[model samples]
Every structure is written in structure tokens, then in C-alpha cells.
Target: MFVGAIEKVDQFTRPIHFIFRYYTGSDIVPGTATLFFVNEEGFAITCRHVARQILYANSIYENYLKFRGELRKFEKDPGFETQRTNLENKYKISAANPIRVLFNFIQCVSAYKAMTIHLHPTQDLAIIQFKEFESVQYQGYAQFLKDSRFAKQGRYLCRLGYPFPEFTNYQYNKVSGDIEWTKEGRSKTPSFPIDGIITRHIGEGSEITGIEMSTPGLRGQSGGPLFDPNGTIYGMQSATRHLHLGFDQVNREVVSDGQRRRVSNYPFLNVGQCVHVDVIKQFLREKKIKFYEQD
Candidate 1:
């Protein structure tokens, strides 16, 4: 069962890493999303934001290609071209979001292509179906809970995903631009679980809008599942709400005017937000996908 869950993730939500290039340096950003089968035919669920990113990335790549064409015309000037090449090497040459799906023990990668994305008309939900691919794997699936009893506040739920890839993929090569995978990179870091209590339910009168979790969901854990102790699906982790704490003043040694200054920084409290699974079911049924439901 454990291996089955891991394999299910391998087929669905892919660990994505992207580098944001700037004139100064490059920043490595890692992300995690939850995806689980709705049926044997491979219909799955995830956050709308995640799907939008895949599409946005494709658009960025196309734009980058066009920009490259414009740059090629400047190659006639040797000095101008040399500086351009230096800039390209210093930053990122391609605006293309090289989202490598960390699957198959991170030995292989798949560049996600958004084929079909049906987003909920009013909710932050998206249903995605990948074009038939060769490396796609299949395994255990998730079942939605139709009973509203499980939606009560104070209920315990757990989520699973690769939350901290920096720790898992410990070493990275700055020069070579590669992940220094420890232990041959074969021992893939399995998705771990984090448990939290439902602090409150939002959108009360009508269909549930969202739910508040006691523990804040990390950046990489978005689109992951929120399920109970028995593994009954409840909601999809959406985002975190950062409530501002009071600001504090800290003395800085240097300032723009070459004088010491006091800098104020505001702290925040992060609370996890989840989209109710009820919304997921409605979206799926509208699409004609079959799944387990007892309502």
C-alpha cells in the first residue's frame, strides 16, 4: 500500500523545480502538488493554480523563442554579440520553464504539457488529463467522502507531499546546473505526511467554500490531499493565509546615505487553506468522470 501511494504520486502530481534568473544570480524554486486518480481511465484532480502554471510556462517558452530570433539579428556586431552571450550565460538563456517532473527515482524527467484543463467556474479547482504518454504509471487511487459528518470542525486530517525538496535534494551543482542526488538519487524521497486539525469551515450557508487548517501548508505542499485518519478525502490544499504581526525595528550597519538606519520588518502567521472536496465532486461529475460517491 505504501509503495502503491508513492507510485500513484509518480503518475500524478510531479515535483517541479524552476530557476528564476536575474542579473545578479539565479534562484532555485521547488514546488509540490497533489494529484490522485478519480477513475481507472486516469482522470485526476489538482489546484487551479498548479494547472495555470503549466500553461503559463508553455507560453513563456514560446515568447522566449521569439525573443531569441530577435537576438540573432544582433550577432552581426561582434562586441555587441559577445556581451549578449555573456548576459545569457550569466542569467538564463531560455525563459522556458524547464519543469522537470521528479519521477522514477528522479532518474528521468517529464516536461508537463497542459493538454486538457477544466477549471471550476467559481472555485480554485482544476481537473487535468495528460495526453497519452509512454512513461505514465498507475497505482492506488483516492475515494471522496460523501458524508458531511467528516466535515465538522476540530476534525483531524493529514496531507502528503514532498514538502522540502531542498533538504531531500541536498546538494546542487552551481556550475554544472545539476542536482547532486545523494545515494545514487535512486532512493527517492517518498511523500511524507503532516497532520492538522480543522480550525474552522468557511462559506457556511451555501456549499462549503474552504476550510482552515491549524497548521500552515508549506509552499511545496499545495494541491495536496487533505484526508482523515482513514484516508477519506476531504479537500485539496489550496494556499496559506499570512496574518500580519506587529513590525519590529532593527538597526542596519549601512544605508543608501552611508549612515546607520532602523529597518522595520513585519512578521506573520501562516494558516493553511483547503478547497472542499464537495466542489471537486461537482466539477468531476460535470465532466462525466466516474468515481466513488455515497451522497
Candidate 2:
């Protein structure tokens, strides 16, 4: 039963990693996002901020260590496998190597799936489509996010994701990554979870809103699907933080050089906000995608 439950959450959430091109003092850097596919049609939803492709990001450090190492240097280099195996066996793991996970957000968009991107990055909501795909492994996501008949306020909800920042993946050579992860075909591995209430049924423009979750959510869990006890998507994991309120005023000042400086910021924000399903449905209409449901 416990194993079955894990499979349930795995259907919707995917491990996300994106490649980015960045510029440093001299060299360009490549990066990836911690994201997964929603509604499983190869269409994925992640924090706009998370998926933002920056040309110059100095804030991010550490990643793809195995690929960045001498082993990677020998990726195409002949006769380097022996040396790479030796190094991997010795250090086991390198301190400088960066680790991120990859997962497939299958192409599952179709008619009557009741899935779509509900919100955007600034609003932090995305609609998604969930088309059924045959598989012994997943049994079709119809068992998961597609149904809404079980929707209720106090039902049990589950969240899935690899929230660990100290992530790692072993590789055989430059072109090949971990045996289990790379070509091995692993999908939607659940890392952690917690329980929460719906607070209210928020459809298009419902005045009902509150702190949707009493418990905290993981960082990488930003766009993960939230399912009820009967396995219907109540909402997606949005955000959580201690509410803070402050005032923003332009502290204008003139320097001796006759230059004025000003500062501005948005303040008085509370903790944890969802884009609401009303918005989610809107995106579905715009995208012309349907949701799948199980009887």
C-alpha cells in the first residue's frame, strides 16, 4: 500500500533540470533548472524565476561535476574511461562537482483532461493538460491528477519532489550519465511529502483565500501537483514563507557628483499564495487542452 501511494504522487511531479548559458569574468557557464512536467504532455510548469534563462548569472555555483571533471575532458577522448573509473573510485565524489536531476515530462495533452496552465510566472500559476499514456509503470495518470469528484476541503493531500540540494548522479563517461537515471528510464521519483487542507474551493475569481497549507513545502516542490485522498489534483504546490510587511519609499538623495539615487521594492506581502484553479482553467481554455478523469 505504501509503495502504491508513492507511485500515485510520482505520476504528476517530475524532477526538473534545465541547461542555461551564462557569462562569467571570462568563460560562459551552463546551468539547469530544478523542474518537472505537469499534466504530462511534455508541457512542464516551473517557477518563472526558476526557469528564467539568464545570460549572466553569478549567483549560481556548483553543478554537473562528473561532466566538468577530467573524466568529462576525456568524454570523447580515447582511452580515458580507465582513468575516469579510477578517479571516481578514489574521490567517490568531488567537492566541486554540481549535481541536478533529470526527468521526462511526457507529451500527455489532449481533450477533456481538465488540465491547463492556470497562472503565469508573475502570478505563479500554470495550467496543464494530462493525456493518458499506456504503461505498466504509471498505469496512466488518470488515476492521479485527472479526477476532481473527490475534491473536498479537509481531504488528505500529497506532495512529491527531490528537494535535496546536495543532489548527485554517477556517470560512465562524458556522453553517458548515471546508468539508472540517464538511459535507464526513471520517472517522477518522490523525495518527500506532507499533509495540508484546501481551505476552500477556489474556482475562477473566488473571494475565498487563505494560507492553503499549514505545513511547509520544499524549494524544488514549487510546481508539484497537490492531490486529495481520492487522488484528484486540488492544487499545485505554490509557495510558503513567514509573512512580512514593510513600506517602500524612494530614498532619493543627491551625491556631490550631482547624481540622484532611488530605491523601490514591493512590501506588505503575506505568506503562501496560489494562482487558484480559476486561473488554471483559463489557461487550459487558451491552450485548448482537456483533462483526463477516471470514474
Candidate 3:
């Protein structure tokens, strides 16, 4: 059970934050996210879903929205024609593809709709990169797993998150129920263990290319890093269900394209998934992060 770094300032940069959506509007209302550091050089790891919305926007829309059309205008409550920034004129994109005004990170980074990711498609794992690196204290993950030669059966794994906490940062106002809502598959811990077995060898060498020979995963804990008894890096969280959409569900129903009020529940699904450590090693190698390969 890793107690995530609480102090906002990492050795290189600031704490990570996120921008998510949930229980409030006609469409998905945006919400917040959190992240923590694993490297001394400011690099951190976080859930892909936590940053996907913003990334998908920039990667494609940045080019698609370059259209010429009437920009959507806004009014403050009843300030009908008072004033507004013409999104079309201001952002070079239009209704087909408009850029969001703001974005956030849950921890270790910020204002990024897309900069911190080197993601795996099916796995919930996401590798984030920073402009620079830092020298924060690492608990020597390499040694942790080495000590846990044979993963203890029925042992527990735990994770720490900022969900259901107020003032995630010292600069927050009195907000209620500010949650992370990221869906996780399995969990691990530094404080306590979760009940599960090693099952079998998902993979033997420096790759995680095997099936679940171990215990399964849980909800809201995706993208979490895994470990061996010595606490060395092994895997990260990735939660999935039959059909997945983990966020705050809006109680109010809104009519959709067909003109019927659709029902989408605020997700409370109990399941999650994770990416194997081999993928992570490849990511670091690609980024020149000097990764270790187990024998």
C-alpha cells in the first residue's frame, strides 16, 4: 500500500491534478483527478481514463475544428447580450472542433489536456512524461518485488487515493463530495493487504504477457502501481466491467438525439483492471528511463 505523495511540490514540478465530468449537466459535467510521482525526475504515473477526455480532444480536434462558422457565445446567467468571447474568433476552431478553455491534473503535473501520457490501449495503464525530472525519494521499488519471491496467496493489496476528500490541496474552498471516480480493476497496499492469490505466472521474464494466474481486480483503483513484498514495481491498476462508465451519474434525465430522456446511472460498478509491468518497462525504455529487466 503506497501512501501517495501529498505535498504538491515534487522534486521537479507541482502535484498532478485532473479535469473529469460527472452528475451535473446536459452532457457529462467535468470533475477533478489526482496523481503521484514514482521517479525522482518529476515523472508520475496515473490512470489513462483520468486524462483521456482531454487527450482525445487535442490529438484529433486540434485539426478537425479548424472550420469557419458561428462561434458559440455565452451569457452570465441573464446577461444576454452584455459580452462574451467569440470562441470562433478567439480559438481558431469552430463547432465541429472547439478547444476547451481549461484543463487540470490530479497530481504531479498540470493544465495538460494531453502531455503526460504514453498509454496502453486495452490496459488501464498510462505512462506520463514531464519536461524535466526530479530527485524525490523513491522507496526502492526494484527491491520490493525481489523480496516477495513467491507472492503470498490470500495476501492483500491496497491503494491510496484522494477521492472523497475535501481540499485536495491547501488552496481549495469548502467543496462537497469532490471525488476522483476513476475505475480501478485491482488494488494493492503499503498500509494493508487485499485478499487474493498470485494465481500463476502471468509472465516470467521481462514481459507481462500471461493470463491471470493471480487474484483479480476491483473498482475505482485503476492505474495503480503493483509490487512484490520488497515493494518493487510489478504492475499498475486497470479496472473494467461488462460495460464500463465510471463517473457521477446525473439524476436528472435529459432528452437525447432520438428525443427521449435517457437514463445513465452515476456509476457505482465494482470492478477494475490493470496493465502488466512489462509494458511499463517498455515505455520507460522508449523514453530512455533506464529500466530494469528481471531474470
Instruction: Go through the candidates in order and give the C-alpha RMSD of each one to the true structure.
Output: 7.4, 13.8, 11.8
Q: How accurate is candidate 3 locally (lDDT)?
A: 0.41
- Cα lDDT tens digits for candidate 1, 1-295: 2344334434444444333332223544444555556665556777788767665664554554555566677777768767677656543563444422222213222343435778877777887675554444544556788876678889878766656654344345778554344443324435666678899887857767898898888776677777775566788888888877666445644575887676656678778898888888888888988877534
- Candidate 3 per-residue C-alpha lDDT over 1-295 given as tens digits, one digit per residue, 9 for 90 to 100: 2333211112222223333322122132232333445555545666677556546745433332332122223433354333223443454433433233124443343333334566656545566665642333333223113323443444444333333222222221226323333334222111212323344434446655422324445433344445533345445555433434566566667788968684757654333344555556566666776444333
**TM-score to true structure, per model:** 0.67, 0.48, 0.48
- Pick the TM-score winner: 1
- Where is model 3 more than 4 Å wrong at Cα? 1-16, 20-36, 57-103, 106-116, 132-155, 165-220, 242-272, 292-295
Off by over 4 Å in 1: 1-30, 74-115, 131-136, 166-187, 245-267
Candidate 2 lDDT tens digits, 112-190: 3332333463456554333353422222442333334455456556655556533333223434432223443333334
* TM-score-sorted candidate list, best first: 1, 3, 2
Rank by lDDT, highest first.
1, 2, 3
Error of 2 at 268 (Å): 15
